[model samples]
Target: MPWIEVPDFQPRRPAQAKAQETRAWYSIKNAASEDEAEILLYDEIGGWLGVTADEFVAELGAITAPKIKVRISSPGGSVFDGIAIANALRSHPAQTTVQIDSLAASIASVIAMAGDRVVAAPNATLMVHDASGMCLGDAAEMQKMAEVLDLISNNIADVYAAKAGGTRDEWRAVMRNETWYLPEDALKAGLVDEVMSAKQAPAEDEPAQMRARFDPAAYGYRGPAEPERPKPGPPPARPEPAAEAPAPALVISVADALTETEVAALRELAQAHLDTAPLDPPATTDLDELADEQPDDWAASLAHLTTPAPWGQALEHLTQTPASSATDA
Candidate 1:
């Protein structure tokens, strides 16, 4: 096993570091029945407050259970430490079932591959990327660090290829691209045996309810792709309304003294008045008397007429002088 010692290396964001200050890296609980055991790995892989590779392996060895279930939700840390932990899980005599509770990212994702059967929650996520490390030394030392990182990356890629059915180079390409997988994608890629359906409940449902603690943005990932929305269609066409018939024009014969333009104007005014107000026989008789008595009353009577036929006859009668009166003029 090759190990690189880089003192004073801090490869975590300030917020992430602050959050993990009091949290345990992992927890093991042996079932009361003694046939099954469960381990929760819910923090960074290796840190000052985190479990070391040796400590994790020792605790794993103590479990006498025939079946061991490892539930993981980690952002990953310490490549060498994670590699050791993975190897320990792989070599365990018991049937090891690894379940991704929320996330398994970076080296933690590598550890997930050690299980005999890997299972992921419907909302769980997996991320794989090339191994990274910081080097503070001369040019020659930096070059050596770069080479070591490449070697580590290649080793991690080999583990993925072995589990997921692909060539080492093929997986290396995917890792370089920093591939992210939803539970379904992980199953399709052979990274997980099953994507645990929401309907399926475990013996203890507490772990199933655990929300995703790993933030992809904190680790430089943009998270899963958003679902595509359907485009809107064009609006429906409206029917045109039916046209109405025009009212018949009223014709009035005026005396020869009236000019053609004045007669036409009078015809228009009478037609407008008749269209608005149609007169009965009683109103028409009153209008005849009004025309003889008061000129103002005759003007007002034209506006009260309803029927066009009677109003036009009355208008023609009012405009014409009596034959006897015309001889006197």
Candidate 2:
């Protein structure tokens, strides 16, 4: 027989590739109400054909376990989807516990905030930065996007503040600097409840193991760099208390940062911009038309665009709802 050359020919596989081996997003296992639920959020946050709020809701809704454990290792993805997933976790009727097995950077860190009790492995990492977006349009459109990003950033900062008991401005500063937190730093910043002890240390799983979409190194990450050690010095004497202790006083003042009308106008503007040019789109569309076409989707997108407090509220409810139900049962 003469040797023949084949064109565009390939051998068939004996079996289909596992979803995890190819897909950027996949559920390791599904849990029922009675089972100890475990959700593995390992990979990109969004902006691909991976996990979405709808998928997360579907998977999470099936698991009615009183307490749910979430293991996270992601470089982060779409800000839009990030907030949505965070909200879903927050609203779930389970006592959510998050374990940062390795890295939770960008929006992944925001999702971690949904946990009632978050624990990070000894060498785990967390990062936060201002919400980012890419716009394609004239100066006006760019300005519109900048304004929207500001709102989104503020909302993210609020999530951190709500969980960590810090002012939004303080969190904003950290985001501005693209701050990264080690396990100990995360605990002090209220990003995590505890750091895993040596005995409880999780096995090493490098970033490549995830096969995720986003790159953790994009942020120029250098792992958890340690602070310089202090030089040895003599112990100082303790200072004495003040001669007279000041009496504590309480006062309440109501302040309006923006008038009601201004807020409504800003919200309407945000909605209008998001519908037609959320990132980039055709020139025109009526706000009412967009809302009427897909009200739930529109509202959810609006919620993500406007602020993050609603997500926080959902997490708060999830935390309390499970406790209340357990007590009632």
Candidate 3:
């Protein structure tokens, strides 16, 4: 009897371009705590410059931490790669926690379900839709592709049904409509276990900052709602000086005294007059003299220009010519 020797199998390394592309999309690092690790999926699932399933699984396998955290901000990519990554995470020994930092759309939303506990930031968004693909061939090939897409969509619907509280058919309907969920909505739907609110006061532009991290619109999502700009706050109260003489009352000029609406109305009236009334060189010269010589009186006279009658009277007084006289002349 003769025993034949078996050759050792060596896996082929990915092409340099492929390796660089995948490296751009994800990072796996040990957390500050020795027993925990973190993974960031900040790009699409699988494409040029996106994370690939094989690369992700290989890196994930290298981590020995008992607990793992996967932070996602992606518009999603290849569905098959996403499925593979999700399954790998689901089967891992470590207790996995998924955090949606900004967005998890399409297949990325599917990967989020692999976590034992899924959490989302207050402004984070999750989107789900029926699986889609492109096929170029004869009628048979097109039909086959359609079947494949339907099968993939069914599997995705099952994943949703398993995580959230609904039948696969119900989830499929929602997916067909291309549903998007905010953190709270996701919680209600059982897609996320928690919507984590900031314990401390967030930065003034926190929502805008979070929004900058991902653009759901690029992937055909409506994207997160625009962050409300913070209103202008009143100036801080000044401390009184010790035993000082009372200061003169602050004087507000006529310009400052006018409300914004009044100013706008006056400007509109002036613009209308300028547009319609013929320019009189002599009247304009006299008005300029009045404005320059008696500036205080000019301002005080213009203050009454908020009303139509007062505005006409003021304009007549400034030009020293009534509309009737000008028309007759």
| Candidate maximizing TM-score | 3
Score candidate 1 by TM-score against the native: 0.55
Off by over 4 Å in 2: 1-23, 28-34, 48-51, 201-329
lDDT by residue (tens digit), candidate 3, 218-314? 8898857799999999999998877977788978675575667556767877686566543544344687786887678557656545655644543
lDDT of 1 by residue, 162-244 (tens): 99899989998999999999999999999999999898855574454332433557778887889998888887777777677
lDDT of 2 by residue, 218-329 (tens): 8898678899999989899899976896788876431244446555665766577556544644244888877787678668666655675433443343356776978867
Q: How many clashing pairs in candidate 1?
A: 6
lDDT of each: 0.79, 0.74, 0.82
Candidate achieving higher TM-score, 2 or 3: 3
Give the number of the best model, judged by lDDT. Answer: 3
Residue 82 of model 3, lDDT score = 89
TM-score for candidate 2, residues paired by index:
0.52
What's each prediction's clash count? Answer: 6, 0, 0
- By TM-score, the better pick of 1 and 2 is 1
RMSD of 3: 38.2
lDDT of 1: 0.79
TM-score of each: 0.55, 0.52, 0.55
